[model samples]
Target chain A: MTDSPIVLVKPVLPALDKLGAALHEVLRSGVLTNDGSRVHAFEALLSARLGIADLAVCGSGTTAIQLACGALGLSGEVIVPAAAFPAVAQGVRRGSCTPVAVDAERTFLTLDPDAVAAAITPRTEGIVAVQTFGCPADVDALAAIARSAGIPLIFDAATCWGITYRDRPLLAYGDVSTLSLHAMKLTHSVEGGAVMSTVHPIADKVRRLRNFGIGAEGALPAGTNARMSELHAAVGAVVLGEADAEIVRRIQVREWYMDALRHTEWLRPVPFRPGAWPNVAAMAVRLRPDAPVDAPTLCDELKRDGVHARAYFTGRYRPRPIGTAGPTPVADELGKRIVCLPFWGGLTESDVMRVVDAIDRIGGGRCHESHALSLEYPG
Target chain B: MTDSPIVLVKPVLPALDKLGAALHEVLRSGVLTNDGSRVHAFEALLSARLGIADLAVCGSGTTAIQLACGALGLSGEVIVPAAAFPAVAQGVRRGSCTPVAVDAERTFLTLDPDAVAAAITPRTEGIVAVQTFGCPADVDALAAIARSAGIPLIFDAATCWGITYRDRPLLAYGDVSTLSLHAMKLTHSVEGGAVMSTVHPIADKVRRLRNFGIGAEGALPAGTNARMSELHAAVGAVVLGEADAEIVRRIQVREWYMDALRHTEWLRPVPFRPGAWPNVAAMAVRLRPDAPVDAPTLCDELKRDGVHARAYFTGRYRPRPIGTAGPTPVADELGKRIVCLPFWGGLTESDVMRVVDAIDRIGGGRCHESHALSLEYPG
Candidate 1:
């Protein structure tokens, strides 16, 4: 039997005994959530790792994005990347704001400053730039655009935790940044998230928002439950301790894919932003237009060959109001070309070889487009 | 010196060893969330125990309320009780609807059906009736009102689990019932919630809503992240096993409160609805208008005397449209008189006696008002 099909996302978990011991103590205290000590310790641990002084862990990435919007008091239209997960737009709406989708930049599939600037209007209250596929966005330019417009900039760095750009954590850029500690991510706390801020007192508001807006008096009526349970926090703490090393292992997995495809003419690895570190969350490659098989067909072939590959973010992208999107030509075009392969910290070199071989067997046509090369996979 | 101050809401937890064993199984699977097997098992366990065929565990009680709304596709004015926890109103708002606050019944401080009918408008989409302090609302009447108005009725049974009304589950009467498993509750799974429905396929919709509305294609725009983690489900399964018995202990503790207050004249126990069994979540009483110490002062004095008590629902409440209320006189007056004492499954007769002794020492005023004497303590 050809190797048991390598799954798309296999989580790298902490030692069972280690996480279990910490959880027993949580049960003994009779405080499972409502910002228990475990949650505090998990937050402190994440703060040290991300170097964020003001941060609050959230129930999920969508909740974190919504909390960030609540913290900033942004209730009008917010600018978001057109080429992002649907949760990003949903979170903006959850914060009682409409999302205006702007086209992503061609280089990194992240928010384009020019597109965001063009989409601004009197109703635009903020901007939520996404770190698409572990690729750093043009943060400085977007920040400048936000400053000129007198609006806040939030980064939905959901898929790019532990990644750095220009020697600084990529999430350290925007006014507020959110992380998704979903099970599929490189590092996770089992269905958890965090909202982080380096500018203003955003994190303080996020904390209040996470707890149903309850102050000393009572609930302020502008919040819902977004608290991460102590059980989640304990797992997070144990998993977080090994995140740096786990991320390094994921990086190694990405290189294995790079090595396997170096000589292939039909595909090239996505060019992440220069000086940006990779968490290997999105080990995607763009197919040559002239290749024998299309993205959907190739994905089918890979599945048949006992290899799992996905055309990530290829679902129906409907922004609310339907007319709020700026002409996202780059994002729209990239959707058809990019395909993500099974990549994780535990993925071996043989798995990468099997993936590349599946690609070689499927393609028969020989055509290459010059229009959207992004960057050539170096030989 | 004061028997550890008789604190309010000490959770009755499952044995550490039992919970830890289940949790370790979750760790071994490395599937922390996204509807893992553990979540499925926990939902099944809850469904069997509650005798509801359709149920879904949510991230928290607040999230459960919102998810139930999403499942029903409600988006306009929803009616809620004025004399209830702020989360009831907040959940309605989070569901993307403006809440119309109806006055609570004078007897049980639950939703008054007459007030609910008066508050309804052409824009009224649904009704959310709360089980205030484990006191069942007039479910049969509220259901009739909702049906005649062609709107759905939801029950927020956050504080009243395993309690019955007329030999039926208090939760079984509504279109959908939600529960809060917050740590302070008599039965808990740390920070968790559940949505239950018997009338329609509400649980199916809730499952989609909790999972970011992802179907075969991709995420629909109307969903946010509200999935409960496997870690939470593991703890819930164990804690749920003991909820029925623990609830019995809580009822016994409540009887001790009744016995201690038999001769008291300044306070009277809240008269719960007829044929309704108590979960003892709210061992609350209303102070006499002419009592020397009002609710707040009594609360303060109780604190000094090593007893903990709270003036439940005494905070500033602002319904979305300030004019949505239909003159909630009963609820407005009741807010000033109600007080919640220290309550839990393990409360002792001695602790109950200590609490009554503190109340006896604090109040010297003998004036009585006829407006809100729901019922008298038997002498």
Candidate 2:
């Protein structure tokens, strides 16, 4: 049998064009390195648009998280959601902290306040609450839990751009929030991220850590280089300038998909809270019980039809030692059912409709449904 | 008094036109993110040129070292030079290991072989030997020490690009060697580095660690994103492509500076071993007793004449600990006295002569030296 055509995970046309233009300027100046004019401009633009005062651009999201954690002096136990990407937990681990896995809230695939509260121990120094699928988690609630416990909270807002609650940006809530501008993000800087902090000391420390831990006028501290170059910053600047329009388009496409799948039994779109506007970074749907299909089966069928769907963050962060806690209830539940459909700035309503139609066709006992149903039912 | 004229650190005119063209293509293609065609090409070209098969590209020299340490599973005590860049020690510490600072050989200004032998304890898992100032160190000696002790040796050869020893590339002698292609290096890739290993397994592991620990076919280990973008890689490829001719020019400039200052009383260039072909990355000289100027004073005088000389790793890694065995003799001596003059592909012989003339005037205590000496050394 012929293998199905591959749909690119992220067809990053806008980023490519913007980055290309940035590269042209880099080429023109023959100044490919340094915290040059373009990089400085990007940092300023990103900070202003995000409603934050201080932002130091760095090499990648991982680097951003590492910088923040290193600066914040995160060394003991860090509470992390088992439902999030592996990078979050890994960042904590890389910073010499033990990642104490926390359960997520079933309603929204985010860190459960109760789980975070329960996981807090004398060793707990920080909490990494990821804003899953672009939906801003209950930061106010999460912050309360962390503050009362006297631990810092880091928002891995990699997926939650263009989101605001109560007229303030979602990222404005945390002590330090890390934003990723990868090709897959609503606004991309090719490969870049930033650590935003209202605290001058934290921001200053982050700046030093990002630049090999060197104080502005002194020698470097014991640290690795995590700097974002001028080319990346230039691309980030252009993307930030164009993101508003892109977000509008993404929101429209998301609405179109929601409308088409509202009555479909197999596909249940994850609910969002009122007044919580997201960038539509991804459209996630949970498989319903009465549905004739399961997530993996439906996903495989959709791929056959050129409607790419992914099991985002599935098995990304496994539970500790297998039998210890077994698994976080929310992580186990969400990992098996949630699927992310094709989403990007260039995605059209037609593409969304095609995905819905494909899912509608494959809702029956096709492919892996029998296997999934057998597992779903205990024999 | 009017401030001295600010000289451009790197007058990047030769490749400006080409860069503009590359940026134009980037703008058109919109493939702005990781391992784009340019980046892939650069990596392939670099691997072949460096004569290393197991090489993985990353965001920076610091990231590269971290990846190497991660790949090698270094989690105990890492021995490094006390007179090297702080990043070396910091990178080791970042890996959750204790950074044991060892004295370097005073002659080579590299890691002291005897110091490495002494720093080894039950916890010592590896050694990070830096090839300071683009000159290949006594790698054979360091290699023998690491091999005899049954520990891995990671050559922090960030500054040793294009240098050969014993008719073979200096990088081939170590278990794994890392190269920096930062904007400051002779042939930079804007901001990038690579880890090369002769052993296939370690190389494969290095590749995975740098890229979020995702295996070729298995699940990704929890790792950070340390990928080098195509745009940066493309720039690197162009530089590497022209490296042969570029190396010749840089070496010629090095020889020119050496000849111009052959009779200077106050500063003596660091001695190179016979058959030790250096890459001429940076020109450094020791402050002589008869000279009327110190390193800082001479640097100031040269800067006023459109030359940018820098203090070479002064107090970068120092003051080991109260009970720790103190400084490496060669590294200690050079760390205090060595000052590097401008060395880039863009600098002409005439520009070099101008720099030499400025140094000559300062050494003779003609104009700027008297003022510099007072401000720099207030005693």
Candidate 3:
């Protein structure tokens, strides 16, 4: 008999249900597009909820990043983390800039401050720090480096929707932050994103850029329809409403995994700073040398045993441009060794036990904190 | 007491319902994004329905135009119709080309071939012909000019969905034809569009371009995500399925308006051509000198009578970025006289008569084929 295969991720249902209810109102009201009433309401709600003082909702996170770059007049070169999603590089390129990949920190699996500082060039207009796996990146250090270098910092916070760092919303530190509410994220507006900045003037420029760089207020500048539809806005409002409870539930689920696998010999979880509270969007673990089996072998074994573990972020590395070829050593190593375990909103303690037991059986590890080699894996 | 104002246009219903039913499936499946199965299915159906061999869907018509230009490596100056949607000019600019406008024919409100040929400079890379108000443009002559100039012909068929010209699908004649499926169009995918091309290689490039220039077969080139979500595709599939019937219904309503207003004075309906069958996406009538009131005054009168009539495609003369602004006589004249009346699937024949009766009462003379006179009444 086949075991129930665990899913990698599923959208939080409260948010999804909220979207449906919100859309019913939209269908009844015929205001479908063009910065309508629903869109305005959603923007206000998102900005207030996320503490984004200067946010303009746009079409997608990619578009958001592109608009931010366009507003900054960023061109020629941009420093991006080697471990980030392809969209980070793509966004830079969209602004007619070159993506200069910086190495990532081995311990944190996020952008390394030292590597980013070293990658700066006279041609560098900015740095794009991507918040990978729903975790708060080291934006504070990156921001300082960018400030000293006289360059802007753009946070691709596509994964850090409900996260905070040092008692502040995660998106607040960067010069500009872009968020994706794509279906895979913790919150989704079907397919939508926004560009948030503390600076009002840049926010205004981004608004114009998103809408085809229209002339200005009262005069229609030549702009395209970068405006999100009411349907999408309605969905976003619903997602925003139930995000707090959903995040709490997700954090609780993440805690179980952290506790159960704290002492496993062959695995290490990603590191986060003490003051940072992550969304735990995806539960990722790295295979260590002390394990009985390597990552690939363990992954095969898990699949055969009906567990659906995926090599995390492999697709992001496979198809980079010629000059931007191959993954950085940290990402290359982790890309092969790391796996995102069965994750979602409703997985039971039994499901967690099943995953833990399977990991222990295949890799031969103790389930106690004292047995772990990596300090990052919390008890 | 104020009367309820008439809407300028209404979406054809059975068609809108068809779209709603498709959305119902999306609600059930929750497959919201990427080149999902529904998007793919819609692409296939559109290819068959439009009689285009290859078609690829994108986020919007402007994006499709940009993608087509990007895929074709189009650069330098391009000739465009002066009196068209501002988006066409914006699209050309986004594609990194200078748009050179040719005066349109007063009769067809389309690109005048001789004018297009005269305006073409040695730097001109192509011609962008637009199908205005659901009318098939003079594509054959434009194609000849493009051929002689060794440049491709692009058609902005944003309003020509379900339209036929010369016994062939209007979209099939150009090198690259783009269609808009915004909420305002005859058929809507809730902010969507597609690009159809005759050349397979270019079509393949366009597909990659829409997807951020990444190919599954090889390395990732620079690209953007102009992807249409499953929600959009689901709605598109349902609309495309019912497009024919919707077109027939619209034509019947259009005929009713034509018969009712055929003898009204000072209001001139666009004359029909033998081979041109428009989608009737919008109905416009120009105010003649003999009317009871001019276009603006008549429009206000209609509004007071609870019929909402709007000036179609009316904007002040905009100059290109250069030495001096080119003249816009057609746009200037049309801006003052033309108004769009209520049309769409949901509007009834009685609604059509109400508008006609309002116009006839204001513009006292009969709208006849020969010797139409303007009407005047003392206040």
Best-fitting candidate, scored by lDDT: 1
Model 2: residues with Cα > 4 Å off, grouped in runs: A1-22, A199-201, A216-222, A289-298, A316-327, A367-379, B1-17, B215-222, B289-305, B316-332, B366-379
lDDT of 3 by residue, B1-379 (tens): 2245557765432334454556656766756777779888988988888878688888888777767777777767877777676677656655656678777777767878877777777888877888877777777788888899899889998878888888887777688888888777777777788889765346667677767665544325345677888877776676666677778888998989888877765677765445878647678787775555666677788888899886644543232332112555675676677777877766678888778777866665333324333232211
Error of 3 at B184 (Å): 1.6
Which tens-of-lDDT digit does each residue in A242-331 have in candidate 2?
788878888887889888776565568887755678647778888866556566666777777777787755653342222112258778
**Model 1 lDDT per residue over B245-358, tens place:** 788888898899888887677788888888988657778999877666677677888898789898766654333332456688887677678899998877788889888867
Flag clash pairs in model 1.
A290-A367, A292-A365, B292-B365
Better of 2 and 3 by TM-score: 2
Window of ten residues with lowest summed lDDT in model 3 chain A: A214-223
Residue A331, model 3: Cα distance from true site in angstroms: 6.0
The order by descending lDDT is 1, 3, 2
Q: Would candidate 1 be rated incorrect, acceptable, medium or high by CAPRI criteria?
A: acceptable
Provide the lowest-lDDT 10-residue window in model 2 chain B: B370-379
* Each model's backbone clash number: 3, 17, 21
